[model samples]
Target: VEHKVLAGPFARAFPDAEFYATDRQYSFPLNLPDSFLGLPPWTRPLPESGAASDGSWGGEFDHEVLTVKPGPGSMYQDAAFFHGPSGTLLICDALFAATEEPPPILTEEPEYLRALLFHARDTPQEIVEDTPEARRRGWRRIVLLFNFFFPTSAAVADLGVGPLLNLRPYELGWGGWMPFRWKSREAEEEAFNKYSAGGSPTMLPIIQIILSRGGSGEDTLRWVEKVKRWSFKRIVPAHLDAPLAMGPEEFAETFAFIKKGRNEVRFCDQDVAFLRAAEEGPLSFSVYKSSLGVLRGQPCGP
Candidate 1:
């Protein structure tokens, strides 16, 4: 049955349990203790002899099901429910759609950079870089997500916080499990070596260049316009893959371009001439696009 139908009965059985009730939805928590949640008493652990294992709980009813929905004030909340073998309640949380503004981008800040690096420490830096291979092949950034039920490593990869950074998306339970095996170690090492030899890349130089030439407010706008033109033509579409996937030569050229832009910024910094440059407002760009299929397209009225 659907979650709505089950909510009332479950709630009646466990009144003190927290009920997350939105205007049009409801959910119950499942917080059963470990003692009551383990295998039934009659069942024994597997034997080395490999004889037919004893039937589970010796014919006792042994199954469970839960229904949940997103909770209020947060993406998810805890839930609890009971089972038959033992009258125990299980606790778990559920996630719902986001209903608030997303966090701002803070990529330029040193702290943010440090956190990003820390999260990526075990990852092969090359795969995530805009390497020559990435540029020639028209590679862009890759996005990966993991679900709660998967292992911690899988979850980290999903959140873009782990070693699986460069790899394409793969399912956890399916054949995708092979990628986590020991055989993949060699590939990871080779990629890491490549990244170490090549150096880190950043877009800060491009930002500096645009800001410098466009010293005034109008110039800043012009810089943004240039960015629009360049990005739409060369960068935006790269979002489909990752930078490292680009071919070697193209990646090298892109790195060189970024390096040159960075050096130009450094050169400008050495002189006091550009210090007084100011604009009426902050430089900003609208990266939002309808074709990207983000939240902007949702029909929900404001």
Candidate 2:
């Protein structure tokens, strides 16, 4: 969410490349910016995927477009979906998978990192796991979601978090499957008051809510149906070490967190700061949790 806001750098970085997005949320000051390749808006009311455009990649790539228009109060208003050859679906910042791979970043001591991972210890058992053969047995063709599960170690490369660095104090809370206690109320309220009222949208809450609570169940169901209809099999996140072998059964487990009751999801600004802090930056995880405890409207220990 920080930095990379400028289209100037991107304009220089890929001068020869043609950029196509649903809409340019970030762009040059000029009314007619030439850096990007333009595409039409998805104003039509069609649920099914359709022929997007002639293969810009010269018949080597066939593109199908799917659109996600999140409900009110959502950070993501409009998202464009792309399906490439071999059933690969491309998306950004919308869905994420929580894989078993170790965090790219660590907390100095491996032991301490282990302690942090203790929180992910209780991941649900019901999400189905199948062998490659089993995954391929019944389905001849399957849709694969790229970056379906975000914040993956590989996806965030060259960004704020990526390439398997040490896990920061805050990133430890990535998977909401773990039960965490907030440190205190005053700390949390102070943060919300400071950041929310006077500033632009921060990455903390956007990442936190999706990882912990899945944002909205209604939206999840809608997307899940789309995935199912498309028969997506693998999840190829931008930051994963490699594409995860997935199917309907796999998507079921990967996205289950989003179905959680909204009442149960909680975000701690203190933790967000910690997670986003510079490497080895100081922040008390205990205190951060306490701060979240306060945000949840729960009593904290004195």
| Candidate 2, 135-222: lDDT as tens digits | 2211111111121112111111133333124333443343323222222334323333333232212223333333332233455556
Please list the residue runs of candidate 2 whose C-alpha ends up more than 4 Å from where it truly belongs after superposition: 1-8, 24-55, 58-84, 97-220, 257-302
Error of 1 at 1 (Å): 23
**After aligning candidate 1 to the native by TM-score, how far in Å is the CA of 229 from where it should be?**
31
Q: Native-vs-model 1 lDDT?
A: 0.25
lDDT of each: 0.25, 0.34
> Could you tell me how far off, in angstroms, the CA of residue 35 lies in candidate 1 after the best superposition?
30
Looking at candidate 2, what is the lDDT of residue 185?
Answer: 35
Clashes of 1: 30
